[model samples]
Target chain A: MKPRVLAGLLTLALVPAAAGAASLGLGVYGGMSSPILNDTAGNGPQYGVRAPVTLAPMLIVEPFYAQSALGDVDQSFGGSSYTRSGPDVKMFGANAVFSFGEGVKFYPLVGIGSTKITQSGWADITDTSLNFGLGFGFRPMAKLCVDVRGELNAVVTGDTSRKFGNLTAGVSYALFGSE
Target chain B: MKNLRLILPSLLLTGLMASGCWLISGQFTVSQDLPTPLDVDSQIVIVGAHIDLNTQSTYRDHKNDLKDLADCALLGTFTNTGTGTLDILVYMTPAGSPLHSTKVQLDADATKIKVWGPLTLGPGASKKVGWDESAGLFNADGKQALLKEVKGDGDFALYAVGASAPYKLRLTDGVAVVVVDAGK
Candidate 1:
């Protein structure tokens, strides 16, 4: 589906949860993303915001949007080499999280998202893919938590597909929860 | 819940394997416009041309010297600045001969010995072409001949005739002599 339509659906899904839910956490995260494909994109910094809403004691749904900074790619044609630099990438997705334990929590996450990569010289590439992640969270206080996660994003564009890995750290604050 | 635990880990493991060191493929297409042609008064010119000599040398301990063998190649670019499509023909003929001095009008059906191209360049577009010496020489009738039997070093001139009416341009820069020695 188109990214804008997916975004609208996500927003609509979040509004009622934010209004009536007993548990909701808002988070901001930053991390390093390494392109794992062979000579496709470069490693760069990514930052994003997420909102997690608890549905059951061990289940949560998180919707997030992340943007990665410019990266470089080298291209060669007919014995000549050219450097294609500064492609900015953006990702939007929703994840289902299954948490275990309290105070210290471990979660396994599965998601689906769309990635848009844009550069100056070449045409824009946009595609959707699946996401997988493993995360750990530490709750020091009733309303504060620290989280670290490693995520893998798989996207395909034009006859080539690549998987990128992101390692991120962040803090979340419970705005409205059963504190 | 126990079954869910087993299923999630299995799915995650599958995702990891799929995203890792494996090759994935897809395809897309992009298009761009052709370059515009130059004015009618402008001509097609030989921007740059060069002959490159690639040599390999090895040390001979018995002879106390190095022996080298070289291969010759011609590389150049031609630009058409005229309003019409440029048709070009390149020739390597003996320098300072009547054939070299002779001016032939650009004709669609003209034939010549050792012709390089009937290359067509759109207006304002530039084309680069290269030829290697080992590729064998050809006569006007496209018969193969040995390079040594043709003409020797510096004995030949490389010239091109570009026709893009109402202009016919003849271009020849001084012959380029470049030697690249790969000696070990």
Candidate 2:
């Protein structure tokens, strides 16, 4: 897991030198993530931060961290009953972005990352997964851009194939080059 | 036409976002072993003990809504550690204290309502005993009569009964496991 996370970070570090980035930016966002299947669990809130490095007008690499809260569930076996709290999920990874427009950008991205899931009465589940998504970013003012995104993360595991949907909205502050 | 193509994907993404918990989080059937009062391994019990079901993380906010509890299971297993064969039973305790936790002798109390079983166990043996009518783990779909005894933060009493096992006195280890399918 350490190797994989390190590899992701290395990819972020090395992409700029290989492609020649035009700008560097920092982003923060928050929204709700619900079970994609609809039958399993309810929607929960999520928040995240990211560093987006533009390698070209159409290309960027983003390294990010997202934290989420999940809803609880209940069960009963005849006389015995229980309520299991929803697990909290934390993810760290990077995405390769392909931007479509300038100033107001429509981008689709794909990448991989590691995830850790935990709950009160259950054992923690940690795995790496591939995630892909789309985003629309526009500057409401100079040096600040409003960002909105929707993504699906497929957690890698041998036991069960798990995935989640995340939708977030926030702002990106320019660190250098472009806002 | 170009803008429409761009808007279409965002619309589709929004539709997926609104549709479901597509995040196939690998949360599976979670099972937890509950703790009992006077909880100890190989505890001696001729009478009964309150297996506290209230100590876990239960949702207090939406506890009243029945939909929140529709999909789940509770499983129980007990072991007899004595040298002789023994008979054991789970009974619903009287109303005030719990749905089922009697301090005194089980049979001596007139109001005891039987929940689980008079499961016979050989010396150093264990078996599954829940609301189900099965040989192994309980897959009971029908609610038990004493289901209300542990509906919400309630508990029941399990004790060795009958004269077949040394005046109903037996050294035993018992645990009830509550399981809920996260996939549902």
Candidate 3:
């Protein structure tokens, strides 16, 4: 994971010479995440922060951290009588973005992260997987912005599997004083 | 339209992922409503003892009957109003000891026994927890020892937590006689 983060930073660092421009920005945002579907355990709000470094006008890389509940996997079929708790899971990942200019930006981002879920009466469930984000952001103001993103996370457990997705809108404050 | 295109694929993938996984077993439902106790004039004998499991009956048929003559089974019933889930456990204190102990997940209610032993319930939607119907005795030692002293008109501090109301069965000369004398 450290290697991946270094590679992303290196790409952002060297992009100005090759891609004609560079822009570095830091932002903070909070929003809700819903575990819709067979999501029986957790369906609540999620909050996080992202630091996006732009390389040229079309390219950007963001490293982020979020605290959220990704919902529970039903353990009743495994002969256990207890309900598994969708413990608070922490995620760390980086995304690559492609902006189409104006207030609209469309990007296909990929990252690797892990989520740890604890059960009510048993051991915790730790999952590592790849997560993807494909969506567009709206910069309604130059320094203040509104972004809508769709995320898909595929989590792999020892005995079972689970997935989570969220379509969220956020209000972000740019620390670089530029959008 | 743009948002729809992005979210639709993931939604479809999540459906596939949810369908591929297995859910762990054991369904539990808890109810706070108290079940009415079964009223019987017959002597309700209580007996239980914490005897060594090595001496316990394993034949499936006699597992509920007193083994090594140690425990007592508390017997009573609740009139069925509707069907739901129940949790059951047994409480015991050694002879002349004030501290009481219980087996882990040792409670029984309407459907099943949580004990590591066989899931035993007689022929109906409901089953008796402590008494062995076939052998006419308490299910095991732990139950026998608890009721050994209930052989006469005496009130002993007992503990029982079930889906039914926490109850204390009154012991009469008739009710106490059901418990066989297990000398402490």
Candidate 4:
């Protein structure tokens, strides 16, 4: 099936599920992301928004949109130095989060999504990839939750691929449920 | 509960597989300086002159068509030949008028030819400078102003003012009458 059709179907399925979920949480997050592959010196800030739907006592599905700022990289080739400024990236994806415990819960998430990178003086590149992450969340008050996560995203285009790691912190409001 | 245990392990395995280097595309580099031979103090002379026509075209329905673009570039090369450094101001004025009277001092060695600069020389040094014909002349404020296009054929003169030790040097080259005949 076409990726767009599959994405549309997933969105349709989520609407009903989210409407009947036990709770929904909306949050904003900011973080640092670093390239793990070639020329790893280009690291930048990433910020995003996410909405989480609690389907059952320990199961949650979250969809997110995140963007990374333009990063500058200095490279030396053949004894000459050149500066590369950009390749800012944007990611849109959804994850199935599995919560292990209450109050302070540890969750492992598996996700899939698309990423687009735009660099100055070069054509833009877009690809789809799989995401993996581990996070911990704590609720100190009834409506307030704080979470931290470490995530890895593997982006694949044709036969080549690259990976990026993100360490993020977020705050969420319960909106409609108890933690 | 049994299903949960199985699903958790499977998810963990997928996560591990997905976590690794894989998230960038092509990189582009912008070149700031051109590669030219560096020589010591050499006689400052105009080596070449030409009018470059900038052209463009597009492809449509398996056919390529040219676009109407009249931009051109004025190119020249200046060579310096002296044991001592020579501070010079090289500029272009309307073919017959006195070189723009605005005199600016050269403060640094690497100043752009668009402004007054110290062109240091040891024994042989040369540099190539060019201006976009459409950019017109440099104003008193050291900024490009008076945008003008080359019309048919016109004559433009190149002049250089330099000071080396006891003697001040001023040299003017024959007028360069640029014939704007782009692509017959």
Candidate 5:
């Protein structure tokens, strides 16, 4: 993980404040994620934090930082063992979250950003990415909310891409300074 | 000699220039398509006509001189030349060694180092393949056992096994990029 990247993503979250956005929700999410093709890194847990700033009653721009540890890719033939450990991943992005309904909201999200993947003794890879997902948000109190989301994140380079799925649950609290 | 050409320059290659280290690279092409049996298991060997190691002067002269071998890699593509689909299992072996069949559920042979594929190719489709460090595990590359065999012997072969010979398929490719060395 690069400190500069983390700093950059954190900076994007504060952008909504200058616009005097209606509500700002700061939250943490954790869940299971696995790749869909050429699964080099097996399934594992992923966790992240997000700062979602509402621009309108139905729309929010969410900036997030997420990371995941990876499992080794192993194969054996004849007797020699070939082990390719992750290119483990870290991603930072912003999504446009569109909400539907009242207290219990349904949102479908789409976002784009960059990803960094590294493996021991090998070169690290950096690429562009896009994530698409749907989320259900529940509010038990006026300023506190709980949400569950299912997302497909794709890291693309040239004509090739690696895709993974993440399903996560999160809690957020709305701070003061909303319209 | 149909089409195997060593791509490395002979200038830097000597048994003792970097003292016993020869960085060799080459490509072999089979200009025609090979047909595979479709109803039962059948095998094809890429040998003398395609991978002519015998005629290449520098390659022939220095192969036996390599004392310690480095992890090498092969990179290329194979095409499905026929209209029907091709399901192929690829392996590298000491030339003409046979023992795999769609007939057997298991093959206990360790000499056959699988380098590529359960590769299925559609009609007129081409897919690239590569193998280097993982070529022969008979004694592992850096350990020097397989290096002795890879360097000393000629007629090293590439094998392809087809499962279920019901309807055959044709394959063609210029298997490009073979690199072998000593030390790292």
Candidate 6:
């Protein structure tokens, strides 16, 4: 692990476990994602615990780690029996989510995070990307809420690269926060 | 051969430089949809599969095939098929010929399939695949070095399906153990 990444993860992990005024949540998320390589669609399963440290009523910082599969993509030639399978892509990231709204009914959110993606079968062929996410959540109770999210991850590799996106919906159990 | 030697050393260096560690855990279940067989004591099924090695060079050179390939389980028997029994084949199938099968057994639980060896169950019985690892892959030390040496490109799939339903009895339950070396 790089020094910066280590520092980032440590900082996020130690996010003042005291749920003071902020909202802490943990959940598992899974859904379909359009991979950057070759595939019609693939399943991505992610499990993470998120804690929001609110700088203000509308701004919160959330850090997360997730393992996802890009699925087996077909890259083999048309007539060749020798077909190739794509490796699974595992990722981890931390984001700053900006929520907008007042009443505890509904709120819209947008955020950005730095992501580290690892490709199986291809060791060291890793990608560190800047991802932007847009989503919303509704909290009907004091400790429970549901959120739907989508993110566009742009990975930079010296010269040419691509943008990948994933959309998922999940329910969260809050340790503390306003209803 | 000279170029191959040079490339091999460079690849080794690259692998060393990129070495880190990983912890992976997940659950996989195979639900078979086949007709049940009638009048049978028990039945067994085998499932074999290989993990994918994603790379263009490996795919072209067939390096992925060099790694040792083996399935932990042998065969599982489903015996409680009272009126009739349904036998179905389940496993990740390879793309090309010479299909591989990972044999599994019916665990004592009767609901889950214990993939270690042969298992016996009565008629009308279904089983799910389950495995547990406490420490995980990271505990394997530098064994990841072995992963680098494995370079053949292959995808997982159900290669063969030979099950006996209650109405039609086709094949009987059996066990087969084979060790596959990459060089072979």
DockQ per candidate, 2 decimals: 0.09, 0.06, 0.04, 0.06, 0.01, 0.02
lDDT of 5 at A86: 46
For lDDT, the strongest prediction is: 2
Model 2's C-alpha root-mean-square deviation from the true structure amounts to 12.7
For model 4 the TM-score comes to 0.52
Q: Which one wins on DockQ?
A: 1
Classified by CAPRI criteria, candidate 5 counts as: incorrect
Interface RMSD, per-candidate values to 1 decimal: 15.6, 10.8, 18.1, 14.6, 19.8, 18.3
- Where is model 2 more than 4 Å wrong at Cα? A1-12, A15-20, A38-41, A76-81, B1-184
For model 1, residues A1-179, the per-residue Cα lDDT tens digits are: 67557645755776775666668988899998887632435688989998887766677767888888756654332243334354578988777778898778999888766788775523466776557889999888888788999998766432235567889998888888841
Per residue, candidate 5 scores C-alpha lDDT tens digits across B67-123 of 332223233345665557877555555553343343232244566565544667776
lDDT of 3 by residue, B83-110 (tens): 2332333343333223223322223312
Q: Report, in order, each candidate's fnat.
A: 0.10, 0.09, 0.05, 0.09, 0.00, 0.00
Instruction: Evaluate chain B of model 3: give its TM-score.
Output: 0.27
Regarding lDDT, does 2 or 3 come out ahead?
Answer: 2
- Any idea what lDDT model 1 has? 0.52
DockQ of candidate model 4: 0.06
Candidate 6 C-alpha lDDT tens digits along B1-184: 2353344335434533353210011111111222222122223443333334332342334342343321111222233334444434332332422333222332221222212212223345544222111001112211232223233234322222324433212222322111122221
Provide the TM-score of chain A alone for each candidate, in the order shown: 0.85, 0.85, 0.68, 0.91, 0.86, 0.73
TM-scores for all candidates: the values are 0.52, 0.52, 0.42, 0.52, 0.48, 0.42
Write the residue-wise lDDT of candidate 4 on A64-174 in tens digits. 888997466654432343344536888777777888986799998887667877754223567665678999999878877899999987666543455678999998876
Q: How well is each residue in B79-130 modelled by candidate 2, as lDDT tens digits?
A: 6655777765444553434322323344467766654445677777765543
- What are the runs in model 1 whose C-alpha is more than 4 Å off? A74-82, A158-160, B1-184
TM-score of decoy 2 = 0.52
Per-chain TM-score, chain A, candidate 3: 0.68
lDDT (Cα, tens digit) per residue for candidate 1, span B53-164: 1111211111121111111222344566566787765554433222332333222223334545566777777654433221122232322211321212312334455543
